[model samples]
Target: MRCLYCAHAMGLATCPLGTVVPILNRPENADILDLLNIPKDYEVAINMALGYPTESPEPPIRYSDKIKIVL
Candidate 1:
């Protein structure tokens, strides 16, 4: 999960591609794992896919006033 989060953050910082998390039980999961030569002893927890965006989206507005800071 931590690795997935770091990869997501890095992707967001470095590229325009969007990230997708595929279901673990999908039929292609095994094939993908095999193709990647991942060890059989390890289980797939999360699968992420990165791809180019087809359209531009408006940036979401942030409400900083709603956030509270505590020390």
Candidate 2:
């Protein structure tokens, strides 16, 4: 998870390891690769979105009321 340069950069300044999104929806979208000029030998296994949060997220729903717990 730690590449030499990545570790170095992170050490120098906190690199917000942003949200990791998958290319599941558009796996076959070669436009991204073309845009980036990525060679055919390589492939995009994962994707990421980096930015500051716009607002606080909604609270998670509690399953306690919905699903019966069986111990």
Candidate 3:
């Protein structure tokens, strides 16, 4: 999986418009809302670290439609 942005994980209780601060000046233990001074109900997407397959993966069995011009 790849890394994704999550406000809650970043110490933010709520984020508006899924906007996450590129840089936070508050401590890691501090809540993101407290740092940003945002009201309640604010939410932002989550930043997550995901690991994808190291090697190329084959397509599913139903992918035959992708071959429009078969030689």
Candidate 4:
């Protein structure tokens, strides 16, 4: 999860920020893991596809305004 987050941050830092799509468990993924020689004991965390955006959308409004800070 940490690695995925780091990769996601880097991907988003591009000139035209790219989207990071996470791929979960799939039968073909097992073959890929084997090809990469990833140990069976270790599970695949995330498979991300980074690419430019096709459509531009407004950023979601964060609800941080509602959170109260306790000093």
Give the top-scoring candidate (TM-score): 4
The deviation in Å at residue 71 for candidate 3 is 15
| Deviation of model 1 at 23, angstroms | 5.9
List model 2 lDDT by residue over 2-70, tens digit each.
453464454432233323324522567667777888776676654443344445456465786887655
lDDT-wise, the better of 2 and 3 is 2
- Order candidates by TM-score, high to low: 4, 1, 2, 3
Model 3 vs truth, CA RMSD: 12.6
Model 1 residue 28 CA deviation in Å: 12
Off by over 4 Å in 4: 1-29, 67-71
Query: Cα miss at 4, model 3 (Å)?
Result: 9.2
In candidate 4, how many Å is residue 32 off? 3.7
The sequence of per-residue lDDT tens digits that candidate 1 reaches over residues 1-71 is 46555755665322422233345435567776678787767666555555444555765556758965553
Counted clashes in each candidate structure: 0, 0, 13, 0
Q: In model 1, where do residues sit more than 4 Å from their true spots? A: 1-32, 62-71
Sort by lDDT, best first: what order?
Answer: 1, 4, 2, 3
Give lDDT tens digits, candidate 3, residues 1-71. 12233543444343233233433323462487666565545543443333443454554566566755453
Model 2: per-residue Cα lDDT at residue 55: 58
